[model samples]
Target chain A: MKTVKAFAPATVANVSCGFDILGFAIEGMGDIVQLNEKESPGLEVSSISGDDGKLPLDAAKNTCAVAIQAMVEDLGINPGISIQLEKGLPLGSGMGSSAASAVAALIAANEFLSSPYEKKDLLPFAIAAEKIACGAGHADNVAPSLLGGFVLIRDYHPLDVIKLNVPQDLYCTLLHPHFELKTADSRSVLREAIPLKHATIQSGNVAGLIAGLYEEDYELISRSLRDVIAEPYRAVLIPGFYEVREAVKGAGALGMGISGSGPTLFCLSKGKEKAIQIAKAAEEVYQSIGLGVDVYFSAINTDGGYVLTE
Target chain B: MKTVKAFAPATVANVSCGFDILGFAIEGMGDIVQLNEKESPGLEVSSISGDDGKLPLDAAKNTCAVAIQAMVEDLGINPGISIQLEKGLPLGSGMGSSAASAVAALIAANEFLSSPYEKKDLLPFAIAAEKIACGAGHADNVAPSLLGGFVLIRDYHPLDVIKLNVPQDLYCTLLHPHFELKTADSRSVLREAIPLKHATIQSGNVAGLIAGLYEEDYELISRSLRDVIAEPYRAVLIPGFYEVREAVKGAGALGMGISGSGPTLFCLSKGKEKAIQIAKAAEEVYQSIGLGVDVYFSAINTDGGYVLTE
Candidate 1:
């Protein structure tokens, strides 16, 4: 087999209205994983650029390593492997940075050894790795990063992950502030349960969001892309949250919300120009709070993860 | 303006898994409303057919009358209106018979005055008229029957409604048994609250349903369509429910669930062949139970409400 590599983009786990179930991919905020077969019986991983600290050399403790090991167990293939991860997406920022690394590593590893397993087949292993990090397996991030576009994880007798087609001219403007809200931390802060009214409103928004994506009506899409269940509770943790959302709204953005948990605030705009405008306006709000911010202008990633180059 | 008439299809409120929020239109199951300028400030309603003695001909009590009344109140227009309604859909059969009349009347009245209000502007009155019948201001049926296609009604604020494009081969087989499940009665039977785990599963299916619509994968669509929230509680009212669903599934139906409330069972199939197979199989079940059956072999309705032979 020829040498192989792959890239899975970082995904915003909850696109406002869809909490724990809905997610979309951002183009540039991603990690690239490269894999090669060797004459050994185990796995190895190394962190390249984009990550601040050295990734664990041991394959068992790291997210990427755990995912690969789980896949090996599933396929019962004892092929020796080595992987290099180009971690571009930020970690611990609700934007599913850990999931990107884990998914990319697994996709690369499985593909390099010949895809003996389907994408959905590998969800449990990937989710298990996520559980180790976030204390639970929420497929909101992993599914999108692994499969691409907007993914729906239907947890049932047999779990199903489905992807939605995003319309054209829709762009995501992402702003990560100088803070990190770990998934575990965010999950802990939330109430164990919520009011019935909140659930009803949230469910209504979920229906509307799915419909908006199908219809591609920007105005309605914006209006429907609301997170009444989680955002109101989670937003309180993010500084300058309302101002940033207001700025994005005033800049002609369709919608704005905290990406995943918090610290990173993102908005959807009509085009690149509007995305940039929204980003600039959002940055000013972030700066007002004396915080450092990183901005990304991206579109809905239709193609999520695959062998980009070999 | 030339004399004009409009027909809107009766929709299925609570499209199986999506109760009180999601709905879709059936092409031939609705009421036709016609309005023309008359000399006096009079609004007359004449029910032509298919009421089963359930319709009120009174201008104040008729569904069409109530909708037109609300429209006139809001518009403050004195265009003397002559309204004619031909109710094609069965009354109080889980199908949104009342909403069809409501939306159709409002649309005819709007067009009578040469489009006094835009379609988006007509939602409030549509819901209000629907309220006159069901004693609730819900848009699950009105939005789709008025607009068309799969719809999500997220928020009345700024009115977030999105129309999703259903797949080309998305065939639906509906089985209507001779029974009545009033919206109020079915709603009353449901628990005011639901189990959290059960809610999570349903949310996953909703996510999967939306994702399945986008990706155009029948397998994913079917898998993502499990209903854990309401179907279990509501499916009891329909006789031969389990047998119909099983027979339909045995006939290679992709997804199956209750159409609206009771008696009518709808299943999504891969194509016309499977739809026919499921329909035939389902009809046999209903016949064996000695019940009246009306079956529709249709697609996801794209054109909701429009003028009929104006």
Candidate 2:
């Protein structure tokens, strides 16, 4: 075998108040992308899996291809590669499946070529690929994947990335129902105008949440994570939002919010015990609704995106 | 000289994105409230300066009186005192003169009474006083003065306060143009609704700025502090905000924003040299506009409100 393959975990974007700027990489999810260094000069995508038999293998229009070419062009490495993708995450699930593919392929290619680009440098490549998937350039999913942990993109130009230390006790229980929700479509249902009062309240929560993160005060963190603006408007799209939140909140979760654009509900807890409880509660809600549930009780992935089994 | 006196600096509330929650204590640029302990009951505020006209000697009406009474009540100590108010900071200049007087009086009273109330207990008393001044309750000024650093207020119930480690290199140059803009009146001009686009973009900035604060990145901090939402609307109240920002930006300052409200512009810089330069630039701009300017260049007062002199 001329090349090896690896998987990138799915990520939850918007992580509460940080829409289009905050995201967390999840474990046990997402797609696997492969890299093959052949005698041929060009790189091509060979096979694909999961994705319900949909996603293109064009290798150019594909999100994974864009990230690979960015590395190939910059490093000037002539490795003929036929990449195969295993799209484990649902397409358009608001779980950053496309971004995972792009990031995984980029990580694999960069690692195979001896890592010519640093993690943060993957932003441009990720954004470019994400633009094709979302019709606009956004950094929410890509940044968390490439750099891992919680990242803040201060300046997209010089690429000022701040890597925040996730509190050690944070555990997330993400439940994605058997429904698909496109980020663009979900965003369209939002209000064109939000009342100033709601905005002010939301801003207070944002500040409070940041303060909570800094202090590592779990109670305050839970209280400050309340959303009065976007979640209310967007939660209407997710059928089980209310039930899942109520269930998890009763099951010893700190707080919960719609991850990214929705259908996926995420709850934070103090430990694996609480995480499992929340996950169990979430699965019950989904089961009651007669829908499939994929739940994971993983801590935040500290190392966002990197080469696996290298 | 049986009693001691000192001035607590006026503060700028809602420092950018931290509305109704964040504040910064400004030194040598607020009201001077000197307290005299008397062997009498209740509180008496007699000495008043700066304003030529009578300011009503009613103890309840006076900001210092309200703050002192609140502190005494909260501390469960009924100590008679006389507050001498020499209003150094201009009223309605968006410099939090009322808050300063309250804080200064509280500090003096607490110290004079053998310090029954600790620093942690100052926020409630200060906020109660601010309620009388602004006709509402907020701890922006009082918290910073009491905490003596950049504070993040998570919740008002349990009163979780987090003191952030502000970068040592960060300095603020405030140019106070001799003008008045009431905080209440300025707050009334906000539109009832904000576009969702603006809210999400602001969310991104909030995330980036908070993350930047933790990382202690000055450049990223400045970049993330950009306020496109509130600043645009509030700039209308302050004449030449655009001009001051442009002038200071050209002078190598990182960023500028309305300090609390209108008239006082705070430009942030990394070093003292740049701070001095920015100060000179702001002064020139104010002078060119035929407005008197008082410039103060100091670091982000990490030690907020404490016993400066005995």
Candidate 3:
């Protein structure tokens, strides 16, 4: 029998200007999944911890089990794996919690099988899990959690994903308030159509952001980190969103935006000291509103998921 | 009196994925404007060539004269400049004819003042001329024509133009059918609003194209050079548009799109040989329809507008 423990970093999707196509992995926070081989030819959920009984116990509904099942079918191997998910990220807080779990479980299962699949090959499994959790199989979150650094989903029909260059000095500060905003609820607020003028401006910003990342131009990044499409509608869902953003930016953040959907916000800064300052500024905003928040600050995770123990 | 002859290369705006923000300069054809410093204090349009006498003769109405007037005011000097306009590019042919004239005149005027304004500073003068020519002060064409290479107009309110790195081996093929399409007419066909899904896809492609240019990955560039915003509505304005695009792509062009608005199409290829092949393929499509076209092939113009003689 073989057992392995794996960890995958959480991801921040959209990154402001890149609505549904861009994301990046961050360190210091993630979900951990442990897998053990069994003689039975079926996947099972052995145990779940840290979720306060909020997650489903049924293997068919759990993100980790669903992802492992897909991986099993892709490998053409009998399912004899049991998954144990440890929830480190707050569920449904726009921190890519489900994606982290799926990635961690897939990495653990691959490790049990002598690592037959490369990291990129595990994307389909993570996407499957995403569909089960969020009802949409967007790769912006999963791709970064798998490949690390900034990942751009160029197209979805054939699943074209590219890993982008990450500036070494760039750091991320994530502020997760203790609240839940369902992905579907947040998405429902967006308009089905947008003005052509806004679309053009959004595209310009997206292009500028990509160019900024490659050139390491922080000023350009700051200018481009604006979400004209979704922020206007979704910002109301998060409490004190504008105040928090203004505070973080005033503390010298490059830019701040709602991560994924709502309740959680991410700020990008130049270095650790700036990231710490931004986190403090954001924390004060939530504190004044009588809401508790959890903060994570770290450099970009260059390695997405890794085996912790075997 | 200081007399100067200046040449500014034509430009291709939008560049498929970049709707209103991306453009690049091309070689082999341009407008050459000769500026003669007059002893008398006043700007005058001495003579215009190759324009079929269609352009305005009044110094206030001509694109060249309008640009030079702006330059004269910016230099805080009395207007003692007389301009001779040479129209190498077709008028209203979607080949940046008006922008080239404005850029050439500005360069000539700058040379007459011992080049007080750098190339980037001349963008405002060119934009002013564009407003008179097309009723919009867009810098997509003028920025590239002034600075050369690929230029991204990130913002317009306070005009932020960034010059991106051009792949050394990249070549452009410009096919101009002997017809005219007004920029305003082409723009009128586009809807005021677009589906959100299409906008997201368009932004993704824009980001991918910028990343591809920096990475020098031809395959990525090919995959990303798609225009979902304007091409669908405006393609009907160009006869045999689909056939020409198909033939050019089949001839191993990275991609093809309407140059600025309509009537002129640009194809990007890896090398000169491939560009020539793409040009031949595009020509055959027009020949089948009994239409004649002028083809221009050259590497991207690294030097946008320059002083030939002073």
Candidate 4:
């Protein structure tokens, strides 16, 4: 194939109780990448849009280029490729911007090379790219972006990934404030150690959330949506976090928590109507505080990253 | 309704990955309690056996009597009932002896009163009794014993319990070394604080195990059966734990870990034959070290507590 284009959905990581282990892909917001064949025998970032000149243009520093580079090395193929990145999502908004770009590039490169790898096989490349953005190779965002739906990273060493069931009626509402919380800065606020009591409760909530998803128990999910480790430490960094959470809860949200590393807060609801109401309520909290917020409503994306044409 | 008898199965709490939250019921070992009505209008431990005169006879001090007393107070039905306890499981064997006794008495008393409560409704009484045995009111042991099969105690306060799925072919092998590790002492060895990295991994394993159970994915369950918080500190208390674990793993057991705060070690395998092999392997490890061990092989107990008719 001379060229391939792919789109990867945005992902919500942590999922309240699961911290670094769980996440889910969402529709309506994502990134797209196009790869065109070239004779130079290496990848290059030829063009980019939607990022407002914030993202790096150099191939080695860009998330999409890094993932494509990793994929090329792994496959032992040095075919030249020119890339174009469409950044539809905001950076550092906690909506997994880097992960979407990385995943989309990997999928596009795989398609252009005649599909040599499975979707899951591309996880390491995406995670490696994510590590360049953040210090750790966490799969919470990349796994869901690559595999679709709800995904759990069971272990980091062996890179074990499990796809969890998502309730059909579940909807996600994200409110991204016009601000940024760099992944590194967001991570710096967390404590290196935690009390055993808090750890046990967090573990229980993780188990409960997984159980709730499998059983489609909305109340259980709501009750289990607590983050003792990260949320308490990072909530102060986000504007109107507590008020937005309270407003979403009052609007019939099943649960609400900071979406990736923050500057964006997400709420889960049982239906689109409730999700819309939650979005409105959350927007009002930000508006009253004299801050601009972008609201998006979407369901769990069953498909992660895919080639637009073969 | 003059006389009622019931049996509560032994439980393996913590279940490696889910310390303080997960547990499962086992067959072949349990405690039996018989309750008979009297005219005194209060509860009493009229008789006891199999404990070698170690347990307290006072209703307030005895685990069985404490649970019965709580149930009586909650129901507001004060009737003189004498309990005859049959302690089939050894105390401090890490097989949930106290939990079994408490659950058995609660079931017998409930049955004698014409079944005033469901099995799950009696959880608090059993947990309260457990607190008297150990300093904490943890339901890991009690929930599985009362509700049957695998149970996850999502939260202790406002007590939320979720019954998890058990694979049909799964078998358990338990080896009780003739040594005691008091629950208080076993728990005392754990560090009050844990590194955040370890806590994150533990949370991941708990989520993975739950997903494994839901999908009946034995490998996932085995892969996720790791205890980074408790077992590392408590392993030294159990004699030959390391050797036994290695032997069980060599014998093709799916996973093995300390059962509760244990001198008892439990192994999971896919069939009775493999469970038997694992038990034999574990027995050799103990026997070679000149220590006697009591081994039991059983599947997950589907019936938690049951009444006996006379």
Candidate 5:
């Protein structure tokens, strides 16, 4: 049997003003999936680890297996494969944990089958995995984690995804405070209707952020990275969020916002050293409140998911 | 007396997906303002023409005088300036008629004072002009007309304006039907609240448009040039709005939307010739309904307001 190991980085969705539409991948931390080719014509889960026994061992119920199943079905070729899962990212830390797993598995499976699909072609399979894990097939996390850099989901119905320009010096500090906020619960706190004025303000900020990124204007990005729609209501759900935000701003962070759906927060900075400094500042705020926190500092992941050789 | 004449191009505001925040200036059509230096202390409106006696001749009530007054007040040096207003743009045509007048007046006045401020510095005075012409002091029209390109009013509180990059081959076809839609009356049709889904969709499209413009992707721009919030309600106010849109699309227009408010519409195209074709197609729609229409074909006005040699 031939075995291939693959890795896909975790991602931050929403990116402040671009809620439900924008996301980007981070380096150094992600999920790893190992796939082994077998002679039998079916899929199976060999083992799972690093999830504290929280993930299912059943292949039919797992995110990686589900994604590979969809891919192989679409290709009309059922290759016998066994998937091994290792969760480097927390399950619901607002850091695209399931998406990373599905992406990693698909990458390894495609390599095991001698590469039949391109990187972008793997998006729909990862999105299928998201449907079962998060109850909605959103591609904000999946697209970025699959293709790398910043990704914009322009429309969901037609699945229009655009890869945006990433600034050369941009770095991110992700603070995962020890708690999980369910995506569904985070969504429930929002009102069905928002003020027309707030909507216009949010769109203006979105345009500004996109322009800022392309022009490499950090100050403009700082001014435009605001969430008028989601943060006001979701802030109360995370304790000490405002305090940490103030500390991050004081630490020379460009901008700070809740990463995806809560508990986890991201601070954008100009360089790697600044990102490290921001991470330390954020850690201190959580430590003062007697809460444990995990910190990750990374420039953007430009290569996305890739195979690894033993 | 040292006399100076200036012309400022009219602008198209609310360019499809970017309602209230995005606008671009058009070439060829504008208002002219002539300022004559006099040996007096205060401002005076000497004569007005081309308005059919509809515009006020009072220096305090006219848009041009109000803008110059604010500029002189800010400069703290009251130059005796006799203003002559020529209304080349029609009133309430949704083609930024008032903005052009204010910008042209400011350009002429600035030249009359031997240029005290940069072009961008004149935005506040133009905004003050908008307050008297319309109920609100919005800069979507004023900024573009003054800056001479696609401008994004990122935020209004501190008055942040960003001039965006324009695609070189982009052209516009503006159709002004024989009617008037007051800015206040057009605004009254909208609701104070909108669905959260609609807001997200709008922000997504705004991001797409900004990215598309920067990347020069005509197809992406076409997909993003859709207005969901205001157009649904405001479209009914324009006669044969849907019919014109369909015809414009059939003529290979990239996109079409209400320019500023109503009574005038804009269709974007790849080049000047395509714009002319789209204009003819749109004219057919209005002509079949027994409505008279005026057509203007222009590339983007890159040089906004400028002093003209008489």
Candidate 6:
């Protein structure tokens, strides 16, 4: 194959109850990357768009380039490639922007090289790229963005992941309040230690959330959608978070919480109508606080990342 | 009905990864309670057996009596009842002895009153009784003992529970080391706070364990069966625990850990044959330490508590 173009969906991690373990891909919001073969013996970022000139042009420093470099090294095939990055998602909006870019580039590169790796096999490279972008190797965001549906990171050391079931009727509503909250800053607000009591309750909720997904019990999911670990600490960073949460709850959202690390708040609902209603309610809260919000309604993306053309 | 008898099986709480949230019922060990109607309107403990006089006979102090009393109050039926307690499980062996007794009494009382409550509706009464026995109203032990199979206590305040699936081929081997570790003392050894790093890993494992049960993935279950919260602190209380764990692991056991709170160590295996082998191996470790041990082999009990006769 001379060239490959791919789109990778945005993902919401933490999922309220499952901090650093659970996440799901969403449709409609994502990043696109294109890889073209070059006669020169080096990879290059030929052009970039839609990132407001914020992302680095240096290939080594870019997430997409970093992921592609790892893939090239692992495959032991140094194919010269020129890349184009089209950023469809906002940076630091907690919608996994860097992950989408990294996953898209790795997938595109894998396709251009005649597919030496499986979809899941590219996870390590994507995670490595994520570390370069965010200074941590968390799979919660990248796994779902790469593998789609709902992904649970069972263990990090051995890179264990399980694809969990998402109810067909479930829909997601995300409101990105036109602002940025760096992943590092959001993480810094959290406590290094937590009470054993809170830890136990959080653990119970994680188990409950998984059970709820398996059983397809919406009520169980709603009841278990609570973050005893991070939400309490990070809530201060997101403006009007509590007001938006209450508004979405009143509009019949199954659950509502920070989407990834914040600036974006997400609500899960049983149907598209309720999801849209939740988004509207949340948008009103953001507007009341004089914050411009971009709202998106989507269903769970079953396909994590895919090539536009083979 | 003039007389009613019931048996509630022993339970293994914590389940290695789910401290204070997950538990499963085990066959072959439990407590049996008999409820006999009296002409007068009062509750009383008529007799006791199999406990060697270590249990309290006072209705308010005894687990069985306390459970029956709560059931009576909840049902608003003041019928006189005399109870006979038959304790088949050892006390403070981490086999959920008090939970079995409490569940048995509530089930017996419910049966004597002609099934005034559904099987799960009696959970609160049993948990209330557990509070009297263990100084806290935790349902991990009681839920599995009462509802059968595996149960996850999702929330404690409103008492939410989700019954999880267990693979049919899975078997359990339990070794009671002829020693007592009081629940209070077992709890005291734990720190009031835990590092966030450990807590996050523990949470991931809880989600992994639940996913393992749902997918019927034995390897996932084994890999996820780690207790970062409780086992490390409580391992010292159980004599020869480390040696027996190694022994069981060498005998093809998937994973091994404290059953509930020390003295009793349990191993999980894929079949009854392996379970028995693991038990024998664990027994040798105890014997080498000059300690007597009683071993039991069981599958996950599907029936938590059952009436002797319908």
- Residue A162 shift from truth in candidate 1, angstroms: 3.0
lDDT of every predicted structure (CA atoms): 0.77, 0.75, 0.91, 0.91, 0.92, 0.90
In the range A131-192, model 4's lDDT, one tens digit per residue, is: 88776787889999988999999998888899999999999998899987887788999999
lDDT of 5 at A227: 94
lDDT of 4 at B305: 81
Where is model 6 more than 4 Å wrong at Cα?
A: none
lDDT for A122 in candidate 1 is 69
DockQ of prediction 3: 0.92
DockQ score of each predicted structure, in the order shown: 0.39, 0.53, 0.92, 0.93, 0.92, 0.91
Model 6 lDDT per residue over A170-211, tens place: 999998988878888899999999999999989988888899
Per-residue lDDT for B196-229 in model 3, tens only?
9999999999999999999999899999999999
Candidate 1 Cα deviation (angstroms), residue B78? 3.3
Error of 5 at A226 (Å): 0.5
- Per residue, candidate 2 scores C-alpha lDDT tens digits across B193-280 of 8897667666556656565667777776677767656788888888778888899998888788777766677777888899999989
Retained native contacts per candidate, as fractions? 0.52, 0.58, 0.88, 0.94, 0.89, 0.93
Candidate 3 runs further than 4 Å off: none
Query: What are the TM-scores, per candidate, against the unseen true structure?
Result: 0.86, 0.91, 0.99, 0.98, 0.99, 0.98
Cα error of candidate 3 at position B23, Å: 0.2
Docking class of 6: high
Candidate 3: CAPRI quality band = high
The pairs that clash in candidate 5 are: none
lDDT of 5 by residue, B1-310 (tens): 6999999999999998899999999998999999988897888989888888988888888999999999999988888889998888998999998999999999999988889999899999999999988867989998999999899999999999998989999999999999877777789999899999999999989999999999999999999998889999899999889999999999989999999997799999999889989999998899999999999999999879899996
Q: Give candidate 5 regions above 4 Å deviation.
A: none
If the candidates were sorted by their lDDT against the true structure, best first, what order would they fall in? Answer: 5, 3, 4, 6, 1, 2
Better of 2 and 5 by TM-score: 5
